[model samples]
Target: MYRVLRGRVNSVGFLPDERLIPYLELAGFVSAALIQTFDLRYNLISALVERWRPETHTFHFPCGECTITLEDVALQLGLPIDGNVVTGVSLISRPATLCYELLGHSPSEGKFTGLRFSWLKANFEHLSSTANEREVMQAARSYIMHLIGGVLMPDANDSMVHLMYLPLLSNLHNTRSYSWGSAVLAMLYRELCRTTDPSTMDIGGCLILLQLWALYRMPFLASISHQSYIFPLIHR
Candidate 1:
C-alpha cells in the first residue's frame, strides 16, 4: 500500500462582505463560495492517486476505469466549463501598479510578485460603510483573490496568489468569460498525477471536489447520511 499523503484543504476562512456578492455572482464563483468545508479523507485520496494513470488521466479499478469530467466540474463546483481558456502571464512586471489599479492599494516598498493572503485581509477585509462604489468593487476583487489563492487553485506556498489573475478580474462582468472550472480541473488533474509518486508528501488543488467526486460515483466509499440534493453537489 502507498503511504497516504497529507491533503492540503485550505478552506476559505472568511466570507465576502455583503457588497461583494453581486460581483462574485458575476464572476461565476458565488456557488463555490457557498460550499461548506468538510474533512478531507487523506487515505482515500492516496489510494485513488495510487491507481491514477497519467497516460490516460483515469483511475484504474478492478471494476473499470473512470475519470473526473468537465461536466463534473460544472455541477460539483458550479463553475463555467465553456468559455475563453484561463491563460495569463505568470510573471508580473509591475505588481504594485496592478494592485493599485484594481485594489486601490499596493504593498509597501518591497520586491513582490504576489499578494499575500494576510495582506489582502489586513487591507480589504473590512469595507468602510461610507466607501464609494469603486472602493466596494476593489474590495470585491480582493475577496475573489483570496478565494482563488486559499481555496480554488492554491499551490505549495499556500500563502499568496500571483498577480496574474488580478488583471483578469479588472472587469467583474468579464471575469466569467474565462473557463475557471476547466482551469481548476486541469490543476487538480496535474496535482493528482504528481502525487502518484510515493515520495510525494503533500497534495494541492481542490481536494474537496476530488473527495466528493469519489463519494458520488462510488457510494460504498461514502459515510455521510443522505441529504436533499443541492444544485452544486458540494453543498450536500
Candidate 2:
C-alpha cells in the first residue's frame, strides 16, 4: 500500500498534486474522513508518530516544577505495565496539567492547566485555548483509561478526534514546547470521550501496540490489531 502510494504521487487520486500545495490538504482531508468515526484516526505516518511522540520526543520545561514518572502513575492505577501507549497517551492527553501529578500539589495544578488557564494562555502564547483542541485531547485520554478499565465512556463528538490526528502529529513533530503537547493531548482525550465504539477501538489498538512492544506480550497481538500479524522474519 505504501509503495503504491509513493509510485502514484501523480495519480490525482490523492488531490491537488500541485507543486506549491501540500498534499496533506488533499490527502489529509480524505484520510481524516475515512477514520473520522474512529477514536485515534489512524494513518500510516501520523498514527505511528502520535503513538511514539512521547518517548522519542523530549521538551524543555521553562518554569514548571511538574515532573512525574508516567510509569509510576500507571502502576498506581494498575493498568498493565507502563508502556508506550500509556505513557504516550498520558503525556499527550494531560499535557502540562500532568505536571501537577509530579508537583506534590493538586487543586492549583488543575487550576493552572484547566480550560480557563488554557484560554488565557491561548491569547498570549497561542497555546491551546481553542475549544476544539480541548475536546480532542479529552477524548484521547478518556479512550486510554476506559481501555485499561475494560469499559467505554460516552463522547461529545468525533470531529476533533477525527480531524486533528495529523495536526497533532504535525505539532508534536514541529514543536519542543511541552505546554503545546499537553494541550493537544487534552483535546484528543475529549474527542475519545465522545463515542463508545471508537473508544473501544482506540483502547484496543493501544493495548495491542503495548503488548507487541512493551511486555513482549505477543499472544494478544493476534486478538487486538492487525499490525502484529506482520512477520518480521518473512519480510526480512
Candidate 3:
C-alpha cells in the first residue's frame, strides 16, 4: 500500500491515491502557536526525548520523581491485567489507540517503523464500531514509541527499534498543502487522543506529548489517517 504514496513531494499525510492533499488549513494556528512559544515547546520536547526508553520499550520511566509505576496507576484506575486486556489501564506496549494492536506475532514486531506504515493501515482500517480497550492501549503505545523514537538513537548492536522512522515521517509535514486528507488526519488525531488516556498512558508521557503535540502529533495521527485510506482499493 505504501508503494502508491507520492511522498515527500505531492502529499502531506501519506494518503493513498486520491486523498493526495493535506486537509488542514488550520496550520496557521499551529504555526502561530509554535512561533510564540518556541522555548517552552522546545523544553517540553527535550524532556520527552530525555525519557525515551532509556532502557527498554516496556514503558518504564527511570526518572526518580515519579511516585508510582504505570502498573500501580492502572490498579488505581480500577483495572488489572488479564491477558492483553486491562479493565481500565491502557498498556503502553499495545497498538491500543488507533483501535488495533499493530498486528504482529510478538511485542517487538509491533515497534513502529517507516516500513510498517502499510501494515499498520491494513490492520487498523477494519476496526469495529466499538473498540477493544486492550488493543487501543497497545496502539497508543506505538504512537508513544514513534514519538520518542523520533529522537532516540539506537545502541550499536541493538536492532529491535530504529531511530529513522519519524524523520522519514516528516516528509509529510514538510509537504503541507490544503487537501481532504489533512482534514482526515486531524480527525484521526482527535480519535487517537480520545481513545488513549492523556493523564495515564505513560506516567504523564502522553501529557508531555500534549505539551509537545505540535511536533509529535502529526506523525502519529497522519500515519494512521494515511493507512485508513486503504479501504477504497481493497473493500471497493
The candidate that achieves the highest TM-score relative to the unseen native structure: 1
Candidate 2: tens digits of C-alpha lDDT, residues 25-139 = 2221212112112222133212222223233232112322222233422332222221122123322344344423221112333322122222222222222334244333332
Q: Once superposed on the true structure, which residue ranges of model 2 sit more than 4 Å away at CA? A: 1-175, 197-219, 222-224, 227-236
Q: Per-residue lDDT for 2-118 in model 3, tens only? A: 122110110011221211112111111122111222122323232333333322322224332222233432222211212221012223343322223232223243544322333
TM-scores, all candidates, are: 0.89, 0.19, 0.21
When sorted by lDDT, best at the front, the candidate numbers are 1, 3, 2
lDDT of 1 by residue, 1-236 (tens): 34757866556567777887888899898888777756777767767787889999998886778999999888888998989998888787777878888999998555577888888888987889998889988998988887787778878868788778898999989999999999999999999888877789988888888888888888766753232221123212
Note the clash tally of each candidate: 0, 28, 14
What lDDT would each prediction earn against the true structure?
Answer: 0.81, 0.25, 0.27
Error of 2 at 172 (Å): 13
lDDT, candidate 3, equals 0.27
Q: What is the C-alpha RMSD of each candidate to the true structure, in Å?
A: 5.5, 18.3, 20.2
